[model samples]
Target: MSDIYLFYKPFHVLSQFTDERTDEESPRTTLAEYLKVPNIYPAGRLDYDSEGLLLLTDDGELQARITHPEYKLPKTYWVQVEGDITDEALTQLSTGVELKDGRTRPAKARRMDPPKVAERSTPVKPRKGKGTSWLELTIMEGRNRQVRRMTAHVGFPTLRLIRYAIGSWTLEGLKPGRWRQTTVHMPEQTQKVTLKPRKKGRGEHAGSKTTHKAHPKTAQPKSAHRTPRKPKGGR
Candidate 1:
């Protein structure tokens, strides 16, 4: 049986076991304080500055399956951007953007019309001639600071970011710093899962034994007796 948990992380909480005493204050809330289960680690991490749904699991294979890029799990975010957002900007975001590092993958984005979402506690800076707007975006890739960079590249510049969902899991009724154990059960026919072994070649053969044989009275090979050759003259 596998153990999986869904946690709603709040802003300013570090995604680590130990809190560092940096300029940013140490996290007052931690997974240990919330979750009583043992041996579970976060499937993926949410930045200390970001907030949303996070997954934890005691099964190492399940962790890799969720966090690894190959899974391409879709993550949804509600972002508030600075400046007036146009349909063109939304279209551009949906298509792709050329960031400083490289082009971002195609994403789904749409400008949210009123009734707009409630304002954030700390509102973004207001522009002189332009106004801020909200957007709903979904993307498959979770690159470092990806949503922020993508929005900035398209001239929106995300002011506030909140992840809403990861794959099938969501924050739902979970408030900040709260977590719940997920009870997932599958029938016998539905549980045919396989994991590749870590070793390779002959080493992977079942019941194969490897024994190291000691060489008796063995001399050095002929190549070891050759004299060192001089390098060709350089100009």
Candidate 2:
């Protein structure tokens, strides 16, 4: 069976295994720091600043199903905004918000009571007068910083975003930088096979039967942790 892992990614943590930047001295943390399990990789990306549930697997098909836009798996986030979110903003989010890239799909958005979340290491900047609010937002599509952009488009800039769930997976029982494994039965794909002639023994006939077998695809998840990297300047 292919390896499947569920990880709770913390803030400032990268979803990948290595930092792509060239500056060696610049401290950038990656999944490799926490995960010693080799060959597993993140199925999709989570931004350095965002924290929440991340799925890793060695199964390429499962990865494609989770990350590919065509599958449209629902991803839910617990978002904290700069101001009290309004009904109008909720409506816009539920109806679809116009972003620079394009209009986002209508999402599930509602004001939420303060969730029992662990305190962030780097606390969100305390707004002097403007109060902060929380919202539970679910979207079917994965766009680069889409949640942040959507919230900003509707006037409430997102200060903190935590992915609460993805499809059937959640961060339940998993802590930041920790992971667990499970076996899954993924739909098998049709495969084509080519035959190769079998080697003949000394007594075997000149003509020998050939055989071949289709290889099954499997997947696994790599190491992960919550380590937020500062987003460059402008939000």
Candidate 3:
């Protein structure tokens, strides 16, 4: 079974487990500081500057689906931008704005109140006594810094970005650096594709479909008589 988790990643923390560049004087925080579970890795990336909901799982297939751009999972963000978000900007954002890479897909964008949640360590404030605005933006595709670039292109650069939701999962009841264990049920078709009948051997249980790999160095004993190969389309 896949061990899935919803983690609330805080600001300035890396999505990965280890920080190879860390030292006693200047330490970098990582997921290893929060998550103690073994074999569980982050399914998708949350930038070091960005904060909010992060998905982690041991299932490779589930991780692939969530991270792949082709899947088009809707990610909702509560963004604090430099200036007031106008209706015109929202319209352009919803219609699809041209980016350096290409035109972005039509997204759901609307002006919203500041989200009531845990504050960042390096707090985002209005600069030069200028007013700032909060917005709710949802996008399907995951481009590198797409949210920040989109808001900037629309004339209101983002001050702070918080990913509020990914698909149906939200950051409700989760504080910064906190995580919750959960099960994500896959489709029947996916289940069939993920699980294959395990070959029974000495001291092995029948009908088990474990995903563990065998040692490369440890080889099986060869028989004098050739054994018949099983036909394709596993039983």
Candidate 4:
């Protein structure tokens, strides 16, 4: 059995527990500052500049299930972007955007009203001569800064990114820098099934045999483009 937690990560807080960049004399705000739980780790990362709900767990299997791309769990983000986004841009975002890595899957994108949340310590720098708009974008895949890249591809660079929900979990009542213990109901264990190769012709070499091995679900390593979720900044 494993314990789960939902944390509302605040701006400028590192998603991880340690700060390799600084020693004890110059310690920065990390997960250790807000969460006192031992042995729990973040499932997926939210960049240092972003903020919102982050899932933490002590179970490796549960973590893999949530972070692996095969599950296709949707992550919804509330993004504040530069410029008055046009319908065409929104459509492009919903359809798919061409990123440097590859084309993203079609997403659920729509204009949104300003969200009511805790204010950031520092305000977003006003665009030189551009207006801003809010958008609610939902993506099923967790790529490196996917939302920010997608918006930028559609000509609306993101100014603030907040992940509001991941799969069924949400930041409903959690406040910035606050956390709570929780549980995840996982499926019951089932026997593994492996398919063996069918019998070959009678004359065929009896010594030759084949078997199909099922690949176990696993979590991927961090990616090159994936930014570190460290204590450094805001929304």
Q: Taking the candidates one at a time, how many backbone clashes does each contain?
A: 0, 16, 0, 3
Candidate number that wins on lDDT, 1 or 4: 4
Please identify model 1 stretches exceeding 4 Å from their true place: 21-29, 113-130, 185-235
Q: Is candidate 1 or candidate 4 better by TM-score?
A: 4
Q: Report the alpha-carbon TM-score of model 4 versus the true structure.
A: 0.78
| Model 1's TM-score against the true structure | 0.70
For 3-107, candidate 2 gives per-residue lDDT tens digits of 556677888988888777779788677877777776677878888999998877765655665676765668999999999899999999999988888999889
Question: What are the lDDT scores of the predictions, listed in order?
Answer: 0.63, 0.72, 0.73, 0.72
Candidate 3, 114-198: lDDT as tens digits: 8898778997887796789999999988888999999989899998999999876777767888777665433333322223332
lDDT of 1 at 54: 79
User: Any runs in candidate 3 off by more than 4 Å, and if so which?
Assistant: 22-24, 189-235
Each prediction's TM-score against the native?
A: 0.70, 0.78, 0.78, 0.78
Give the RMSD in angstroms, all C-alphas superposed, for model 1: 17.2
Give the distance in Å from residue 211's predicted Cα in candidate 2 to where it truly belongs. 37
